[model samples]
Target: MRGRKTDGDDERLPVISIVGLGPMGVRIGHALQAVKTRYTLLGHDVDAARVRAALGAGAVDRGTWSLAEAAAEADLLFLCEPVDAVCATLAQVAPHVRPGTLITDTAPLKAPVLAAAAQWVSEGVAFIGGHPIVRWPTDGDARPDADARTPAVGDGGGSVAAPPAPDAGSAAAVARSPA
Candidate 1:
């Protein structure tokens, strides 16, 4: 039967740390929370108040004042600091960070952040750049059924298209994995 064909699937979500608990950081946390399968969220900031605010907002499961504690256990660390603070924060935190983790910073100016990421490269970790084209207010949270699907492109015209429905196995992967 069709029902009997689907049973075994358990994909663990990676531990994610958000370094700056600003608006973007809050939104990222909200989106990951909306996905709601499993993940350990470590959030930190130099401001003790921001740490408390993120925890109070339910944006992070745990909040720490120590950057070292946040970086040690994360599989991916998102630096959400202000444009000017990104490089300085990286300089302080990069040395103690774990290998093989994905490091991303959300500074408005790309050039400086890019240069800093390049300078702090380690053997196992990958430094990538990310900027959210869309912005959200501090009070907002991600919609629970936000429909996070990639749209396909139409060939002849400028119209957008949708991909074919994935199989049950692929559907399970999409449900459990982080974007």
Candidate 2:
């Protein structure tokens, strides 16, 4: 996404909050930085050490332990947790999310998460399911290190699948429909 110009030649950047700091989340944070997107990245994790690691690695501009604080400030929220944990994390932040905040997940499975997000829709949250496919070298492989500057697509390629557009209502309502 392009940045919008503001007064005095400054640009307004988007704020993206990433709620997990594991392998996938760190990879995403690096990807965003590699693309040079002018976005303020906020990193949050239940484990404070992970947040610190992300911050130290320049994966995020800020780190927080509070889910509500992250949800309240982010224009976009990425739930980068395990499939089973996604719903619970969403519930924890649903009440704090601002209207029109776009919430998406990187969970491999969507059915369960979509089902649980319905309640969030009623609370004015916009949720969409996203899965990004990337191939990584397996252990014992002799391939060179992957370049962080480029997208991670290789012979073991996969495609991203996004669920149907969420309804204008609460997340709960959107969950009931087939994607």
Top TM-score prediction, candidate number: 2
Top candidate by lDDT: 2
- Each model's lDDT comes to 0.62, 0.70
Candidate 2, poorest ten consecutive residues by summed lDDT: 170-179
Please state the error at residue 31 of candidate 2 in Å.
Answer: 0.6
Q: Per-residue lDDT for 20-109 in model 2, tens only?
A: 987667667766777755678888999988888778777777899998888877788999899879889877887788886888888988
Model 2 residue 80 CA deviation in Å: 0.4
TM-score of each: 0.67, 0.74
Tens digits of lDDT, candidate 1, 46-105: 878877777777778888898887776678888888867878877777777777787777
What's the lDDT of the predicted structure labeled candidate 2?
0.70
